[model samples]
Target: MTTQTKVSICLPTCNRPDLIVECIESCLAQTHTNIEILIGDDSKDDRTQRMIATRYQHEPRIRYVRNTPSLGQARNVSSLFNRASGGRILLIHDDDYLAVDGVERLVSLWQRHPDLDVAFANQYEVDQAGHVDREASDRLNADFYRTKSAEGLQQPPGRTGLIQMFPNNGWMANADLVRRISYKEQYGMCCDYVFGVELCLAAKQVYYLNEYVSFYRKTDVSISMTTKRSTSAASVSAYAFIEKLRLDRPLEPARKLALRRIVPIVVSVYSRNHDPIKGLRIAAKNLFAYNYGFSMRLYYHLMMISRSMLTLKPR
Candidate 1:
């Protein structure tokens, strides 16, 4: 914690030694000189360890730790969170790479507003061959509400996160804030989402820069692509309670509007998993909570629920 700015790039990687090279290279290529790349490797084999040792052993800026017994994704991230040393920390997935100036840009954002607790920018979507998709990247930002209009300090930052703007990629936070909120296994796939909310809640000033700071790769091996994630009823209930207890009274309407947009997707995912009962349960809970009238959105959800019930796979 010197007067000089130093950023710790906490990267949690597993089994993808070949893919991680680009990520590491990008980190090393950063314009910011004061950075430590902490690589927490959870690979089953020693390939990643050998690769890092062979390429970066002499490098003072990099630290490599291979977990004796694999830490999985959540625990591995928790380990990185605890070991981070810089004033600010950026969490990078193994398959993703930062812009050459990513850390510098993010740090500069904080330097301008020294009291800012968390800062992040939009990201570009890249393919397996590292080709950036302009349209997909723009749509990604738009969908997440990372538009120019939404730039600047977001009050009650939890609402911005609750609405899905705070992503797992391309963000940096104060070391204390990141360490204060450890990863939770109970949230399942939604743990990252919940973590974002917790970080924003802990932060006094959270700013969204309208610039693209990193590349989010869309690979076949990605968690979202390789697996089907079902949002549990427990997760829905927990999110609802979080909104009720933590969100401001004026933000109630905003939360409801956000939930109105998200409920259909949650219900559809449950339906796809052939768990119509759970889907209906969530749908009914929301409908009853708001005493919703028969609007088109309500009708559409009702129809989706009705179709799912008829087509339910037997237990």
Candidate 2:
């Protein structure tokens, strides 16, 4: 069937020139031919630019733009959104790619349901050396997306609710949605969480496909997993931003009640890669003092107990 819905895959990349070629190649191989692959490169190195231009230069659909000065991660992603031309924009990270026929499936479902404001399916987690990990799917721990329809609304405009939409930051939404909201600069690590909340709150309908469409390569080098002393500040800032967003919105009594149930889980997420005591300290100093209420207090007290129990559990 002929379709007019154009999809733009915006890939924002940096230093990894070697991995990017495969990433672009995967997009080029999509069965859905109506795709414009926009590459926003932040690398100052001419070699990376030369490599992208040389390999995909012949492909008319490929548009490569190199930033004169690196805009860093979050802004570069936001920049790519501004430059995107397709009706649908997929904010693909540098190290990720669509599975074969992945774009086709997304396009097909989107075409079938034009009313959906957003759509995201499952994605695979590949290892650093590029070996596909069959087990990463298990870690997701829920059929949250599969059971849901292609279009619907998400509730509670904050981190807890946003994670349910696209767990790995892989999905396609209307380009207009991208323009409607900008990533919260304050939350460096969790900007997507804030953005997702904004999108879900605005969207009348959202979609979730059970099938896995993209491969998220998990490596020590990837930004999210890496822990350094310098990044702790940024991580703490993200948590504070999330706390503020959660508290700012006027929510119903029931949803707020549900949020109370989930605070300890949120605390543990922040502590997984860092010291538990330090993460709790950040939570207490920032979220507790500024945003504490029914849920925050419940979470703080629960986190204290959970942290101790966690220490006792065998790894």
Candidate 3:
């Protein structure tokens, strides 16, 4: 690729007029000039569109699209990719903003390592007040740092590392590759995880840059935070997708072990949405089939009991 390779920051927004400006400004502030900020606005009101029109209308690198009646979240985000004209794509949420030179650093890394199919970096989770929650951020990303090699490069822990630490908003990839493995519209909450796994499995080489790429705002209103109440169909679909990968892919022993460790977490979520009986049945099937560790089996057993107790009706 040439030095002038364009990078598209595909941001999908809906009723986030308060935060969308900062996101757009961050994309505009990138040191790399060869970039475009594609905003697919799904806001019910005209606030976001008006703001963009009034403030960023003259900016040549920003392309704004307003949905007539709102396309919801998944389709709205997927549409941004359809309109993107860059060689590389970074799908960022409207509430999340880059670290000023984040795009420049990512582009530079890709330029140095031209063979990389996808590149991701660590992120700082900030609050609604824009304060970095260092404690929470560190806790969330501790695994990646712990697994870092002596060469400063973080190796995938196992075959399923990509699925486990799929950078939801802190990653960039070749536009062509992303387009080929597009996000599934049916997946409501776990689309990014599913897409991330697909990219990792298909990629020739996935790189992890040490730089902090973006600030992911952890607000109560975010999809992840809101979806914790009930197990979303999307979450169930994502778990099933991973299970299919485990069965179909000729994974190494380490990878299968890593996957086994992740199954209980999915089962817990499934239990919260459905019932403990269903969760236990699925858990038992996997535990017996995979011959999971004693600790994992114990954890699942406890989870089933806890869920059952929680669902008990008042006499």
Candidate 4:
């Protein structure tokens, strides 16, 4: 008596011909039949295209697209939505493949809880050869998908709230929710983090599935772990979001205290990975804006102090 909910699995891949087939195959093999797979591949090499044409040419539900160069990940992802034709959308990265029954489980859960804006499942980490690694639990943070409301999301301002809320890997969102809240165009690596945070903050209900529905490939050369600007973009964007939050919402002293602790860590992680100059600049800007006040300023100063200490210390 219920209408079948359609799913659009959006994959934004870069030059992973070897991985592409498996990723698509896993999605195609979903226990849920009412699903469409959309690929927004930006591979400089055409191996992925060749593979799709030769091996996957028979699939009707699969659509593959080649993104023009230099569009970047966030923009490429935006384009994926345009190609989507399902009631719900799942943004699956190229290097990640879903579980055999992942889509079916998600659909069953969503049907039971239509009020939830976002739903995330557990994922495994594997090496290039597809050997699973149990120790790479860091790749899978299940807590982020924990049930949270907009009101309960407020915490004594710091990483505690952010980490507690966004402690996971891939997520499924209501297509309508995404269309209503735009992704920060400039966000590269951290776009997922920023997007997840924004969506969660605005969502009335969120769900966590404590089951591994995907395998996140853990290679030393993966873009996420690399020192690319995309990797550090989330920090800059989060600070920007904090400023917006400060203007839009008023929080208690506890929340403000948490913010103070969070800003420094943001800068510290940014500086260590990407541009120290940009990190310092953001810290100074936020501090002068009095976003979190003197304690946060002190925290950034402490990070610098520690760096200096390490520099001056004998190795």
Each candidate's number of clashing pairs is 0, 3, 0, 11
Q: Over the full model, what C-alpha lDDT does candidate 4 score relative to the true structure?
A: 0.65
Which candidate order results from sorting by lDDT in descending order?
A: 1, 3, 2, 4
- Residue-by-residue lDDT tens digits, candidate 4, 198-226: 66667776666666677877776665556
Model 1 weakest lDDT span, ten residues long: 232-241
Candidate 3 worst ten-residue window by lDDT = 150-159
* For model 4, the run of ten residues with the poorest summed lDDT: 148-157
Any idea what lDDT model 1 has? 0.80
Q: Report the C-alpha lDDT of model 2 over 1-315, residue by residue, as the tens digit.
A: 514778888888888897888888888898878888888888878877998777777889888888888887778788888888888888777788788787777767665667767767777778766777766664552433333343333333232244444554668788998778857665676677667767766765666677778887876776656643333433444445445554444643423333333344455555654456654665455443334745655465556646655775466
TM-score of each: 0.88, 0.75, 0.85, 0.74
Pick the TM-score winner. 1
Question: Candidate 1, residues 48-103: lDDT per residue as tens digits?
Answer: 99999999889998999999899777788888889888988998988999999988
Q: Residues 140-181, candidate 3: write the lDDT tens digits.
A: 666544224412223442233434565777578889888888
lDDT of each: 0.80, 0.66, 0.73, 0.65
**Error at 310, model 3, angstroms:** 9.8
The positional error of residue 59 in candidate 3, measured at the CA in angstroms, is 1.2
Query: Of models 3 and 4, which has the larger lDDT?
Result: 3
Clashes of 1: 0
